[model samples]
Target chain A: MSSLILTHTRYQMLEQMRIPISWVASAFFPAASMLAFVVPFAAADPVAATRATGSMMMIGAISAALIGLSITVSQDREQPWNHYLRTLPAGPLPRFAGRIFTSMAIMAVAVIPVLVIAALFTEAAITWPRLLLGIGALLAGSVPFMLIGLFLGFTLPSKAAIAVSQLLFFPMCILGGLFLPPQIMPDFVQALSPYVPSRGAVELVWSATTGSAADPAGLVMLAVWTVAAGVAAVWAYRRDEGRRFA
Target chain B: MAVLARSAEVTRRYGDVVALDRVSLDIRAGELVGLLGPNGAGKSTLINLFVGLRRPTSGTVELFGGSPRDPLIRRHVGVTPQETGLPEVLRVAEIVDFVSAHFPDRVATPELLDRFGLGDLAKRQVGGLSGGQRRRLAVALAFAGRPKMVFLDEPTTGLDVEARRTLWDGVRSFHEEGGTVLLTSHYLEEIEALAQRVVVVGHGRVLADDTVQAVRDVVGVRRVSLVAGTLPELPGVLGVEHADGRTHLVTTDPDRLVVELVRSGTPFSGLEIRPTTLEEAFLAITSQETTSKETTSEETTSKESTHV
Candidate 1:
């Protein structure tokens, strides 16, 4: 199973490597955004600037997760390559593990530049501990949403999935403080925001950058959402097991 | 002896639709079995089940005496789906190599490509190839793992006549090398030419399973041709058509008719005697089913009328 997972991971890496433009954008976008902060109009507090930068990184991570999972799963579903894969001796574990590993790897690459940009542009104290926590939080935050994308890719029609992905992408970003600070929102909205996976992820990122602890409840909530989405994906997969490419 | 493949009471359902209704079949080593069915007849579903793409809702599907999902079984099974969609960006050789990576003992891909007439296109990207070339490439990929059991769904769909004949040779060669093949196709001629035994599926059920000759026997074979000049009235003649100064007659005994015609000194210009093709047998069987269905409906309707 481990070997199969590794094989799938390798396949995903190869697939990502094939898309040169996407790779370049994912690796460079964070640095470009960080440079934007150098303008005089930006807020002076390095912690605030770092928090904002971290939020942008969260956005990139989520987008990467969505696009990676969506395209990979959708193409597999559409072409029904899984049918061929499933016929092999490797079983479902290798195939599923490969997909998850691939998405995670893409997420990892996407997060790197954001961290680098945040480290460079902000005068806010950046400790190794904070960096690790921020990375961990970002990953945890993206997992559930990525699972959501997986569900859509597996369950929805391709056109509908694409539309929904586009529709949810910006709204989730806006609600999670990608373009604005959560603090500026009305208290009721802010209170409601953490339930959103993006909001929880962004908060985690902010906490990591500021050397503060995010709401434990929010992290727990994100974990729960992730678990639920994962379960849903598996269930959806099993229910439609035999009917692939039918 | 190679176990080849086996399925015991394998059933698969999609919500309210039963895609395969309690199907069971077995093929011995080196035997080419044809899965014949019209659209939505569960041929593809059965192939998917055998290949472990779909788990049976009930019962078991085994390959080489092991569970379908067993790695040991998978190592020996190769599949080519009806819809061949190889990665467009990858070269034919790269596609073959990528698939080969999964198997510990991969076949020499160049040899398979050469056999499939794809050696020239090995370095060419799949997207640039014609439909038939891509299909040939897909078959080469299936052969790369040197599987003992191969499942080919409509294996020769887009191929020209020559290409199809070449594919038939490939299939025969696989059997010669002690490989088992289960093929599904709507093309009856292909099945007749390749399969030793043929299984007919209808409404997600196995309607008939027998040797190709046995299936033709069950369906009944007869030669029919147009005879010009004096018409001889005969019993058990299934059909007669009079057109263009010729009388077409379908009879179970063609030799008897030929002798009769010769002895009678009948002047017949168009004397064609052809054995019953698989297409005729299939049509007869399915049409018989439809006739039975219509009879049942009529009986139900008449009973309702009596009640009224």
Candidate 2:
């Protein structure tokens, strides 16, 4: 299983390096967004700007995870590799773990440029403790969304998966508080927002950046969603087994 | 000990359609067995079952001493599937390397690639290769792991005559090295040339399974043609037709007819004798089976209508 995971990770890294599109979006998007924030409001407080910057960074990571998982998993299904993997002794678990791990690694690399851009553009606090907390919060918040991506990858056809990912990204980001502060929403919307994966991630980011204790209720909800998505992914995978490339 | 290498009494169904129905066979080791059938004869399905790609709905598929899914059994098995599913984005070398990783011991990629005439194309993307090249590469991948038994589905579908001969040489060499091969092909000549035993399948069942010569014998007739100067009415002859100043006789014993023709000293300029081909036997078996099935269905339908 470990060997399979390592092999998958190696392929994923090689594929990412070969494709320029992913790097362009990963490096440029957050930097461009940060520049927009800094240029417009030079007088904004460093702490507030950093909080907003961190939320935007979280949004970028979530989006990347969604897109990456959908495209990669769908392509894998279309290829013979999925069938070949099934014939292997390791079975689907190793392949699934490898893909998830690779996606997480890619998402982490994607978050780096955003952090750098935020540091350069705004008077955002770049203390070691805050940076650690920020990175941890971003990763934790990404879990539910990544799981959601896995669900989408497993259940939907390739074209539908891409379209659904694109369609869901912005609406979820807006409702979940990645685009706007969750507290500013109406009470009914705020109540419903906790169920959305992006909202939970945004709240985690908000708490981490603002030095607030993590939202226990939101964390629990995210965990439930993650677990539920994981179960669905396994079911989908089993159903798809022996069907591809045959 | 029994010479049979594997046996199956397998059935598989997809929703309401029965893909296979109690299909049973015994394939002996070191014998190249041909699975001959038309489309939808469950040829692919049976191969899939042998490779552990699909679980049988009922009954058993035993390979060697155990099921096909047994890792110990699989270690000695290789399959070149009908559909070439080589990864398009991967280079030839990478694809070979990736599949080689699954085997217990590392395969000689460079030698295998060179043998397949893919040495120069190692760095070329799989999608860029021609169809025949892709087929050869797929076959080469199957050969790399040195499996004790190989399953090839229509192995020579996209090869030129020369390439086909080359592949035949490779297959002969593998068998010479004491490997068992189960092959399926639409080309009767290929089966006749390569397989010592042939299993004809139709409507998800084994219509006939025997040696190539044994199958021809089942049809029990040969065609004998001689010049029209004089022809003898010989016993055991099924029928005779005169055409184009020659007599053609369908007979169970062509040797007797030939003896008679020579003794008569009837100014025969040319005499040709040909045994029934596998193609004729296969067509007779499948068509006869289909006709019987149609009659049974009709009888049942008429009886039901009468009762109603």
Candidate 3:
């Protein structure tokens, strides 16, 4: 089973590599956003620059987790090849794990440009160990987004997945305090921010990199959302199974 | 001989639709069985049951003495659905390798590719391949696993004559190597050319299950065409239709009819008596079922009316 999972991961990653433009598209936006907004405004202050860089990096990783994973999962369902795989002895586990692992790889690739820009142009200062920890924290925090992606992918048709993933993307960025600090947003929006899973995610990243105090409510909400998304993902999978093969 | 697969009085229903009635079937080892059915005749549904894709609404479907859903049973069975969608991004060889890795034993990638005549296009992406090529690849992957039994649902649906023959060669080779196969096809000729045992399905039930020749015998249709000016009252004359100034008589015994014609001194110069082709035989058999079903339904309606 381990070998099968690894084989699935390798092949899925290779499949994505064939479409080079997708990688560029994923890495492009957050990096472009950093260059546009952060390079000029937040580059001088060490604390502000560091926090902003972390937010953008979270933005890139979460986008890959949510959008990239959702679209691929939805499209895979439409293929006959997926039918064959489900009929195999390996069942769905290996394929599911492989897809999650590949999404992580995509997340890693997406954050590179943001990291490079932060290091070169901004005065964002963090020790090597802290930077590595911040990266790990960002990935761990992206779990809910990955589960959401899986849920969306399994439940929606490919065309609808595309539209819905795009629809859900920006609101997450805004609520997570990626674009602007929650403090500066409307009072109601700020109060609502702590309840959004994204805010919890970026708070973890911020604490790891800039020593920001984490919000307990946001962290608890993120945990709740992760569990909720995981259940939905599994439910969506069974629903798809019943519809197609039952 | 051991049974490789069996369904015991299986019935499958989709909401109000009865896709398969209480159908019982046994497929023995090393036998190539052909499933013949018209559209909506439950060929795919039955295959799905055997492959463990769907559970029977009632009754049992088993493979290799175990439920097909069991991985141990599935490890030895392979299937090609009616239509396969190959992942477009991967090259042919890569996809083959990916599939072959799942089995404990497999046909060598090169041998599998060569058998399907796909050796030259190994590096070409699947999206770039023609529909025929993709189908060939789909069939080739089924054999790649070196399965003990295979289910092929219209494996040659989109191929030209040469491609069909090439694929038939692969099937023949696999069968010769003692692999059991069950296939479904609209092309009766394909079944005639490949299947040793024939099973005909109609209206969600098995109409006939016998040897290929036995099923053909059950059809029992012969065509007797001759240039006879006046038609004679003949024995075993099922129907009479004329074409091109010739009387075409449908019958069970053409030789006897010809002998009768000769004895009666019916002035016939151009005489032709030939056995019905398999296609005609199939139509004759399926249409007979339709007629019988209609009669039964009419009887039921009359019985209900009497009660009213």
Predicted model with the maximum DockQ: 1
Could you list the chain B TM-scores for each candidate?
0.81, 0.79, 0.84
Candidate 3 regions exceeding 4 Å error are A185-195, A242-246, B14-16, B81-84, B160-163, B227-275, B289-308
Q: TM-score of the A chain in candidate 2?
A: 0.88
lDDT of 1 by residue, A8-71 (tens): 7676666667776767676665556556643232446777766776777787777766655765
Positional deviation of residue B80's Cα in model 3 after best superposition, in angstroms: 2.5
Who wins the lDDT comparison? Answer: 3
Q: What is the lDDT of residue A16 in candidate 2?
A: 67
Model 1 CA deviation exceeding 4 Å by range: A19-42, A104-137, A163-179, A193-196, A207-210, A242-246, B1-4, B8-22, B55-60, B69-72, B229-274, B293-308
Deviation of model 3 at A140, angstroms: 2.1
Candidate 2 regions with alpha-carbon error over 4 angstroms:
A15-17, A22-43, A79-81, A128-140, A163-175, A203-211, A241-246, B1-8, B62-73, B81-84, B221-271, B290-308
Per-residue accuracy of model 2 over A1-246 as CA lDDT, tens digit each: 477567766656656666768777766766676567553663157766777777778777877777668766776665554554454434556567766776667667777777776666667775777777777878877776777787778777788889998888887877777655677888887888877777677667767777766566667778888788778877776666332221
TM-score of each: 0.80, 0.79, 0.85
lDDT of 2 at B107: 68
Please give the lDDT score at residue B176 for candidate 1.
Answer: 90
* lDDT: worst 10-residue window of model 3 chain B: B299-308
RMSD of each candidate? Answer: 6.9, 7.3, 6.4
C-alpha positional error of residue A220 in candidate 2 after TM-score superposition, expressed in Å: 2.6
Q: Can you write out model 3's per-residue Cα lDDT over A1-246, one digit (the tens) per residue?
A: 899999899899999899999889989988999999899999999999999998888888878888888898998776656657666667666777788888778878888888889999999999999888898889889989989999999988888988999899899889778899888998888988998899999999999998878889989999999999988988887556322322
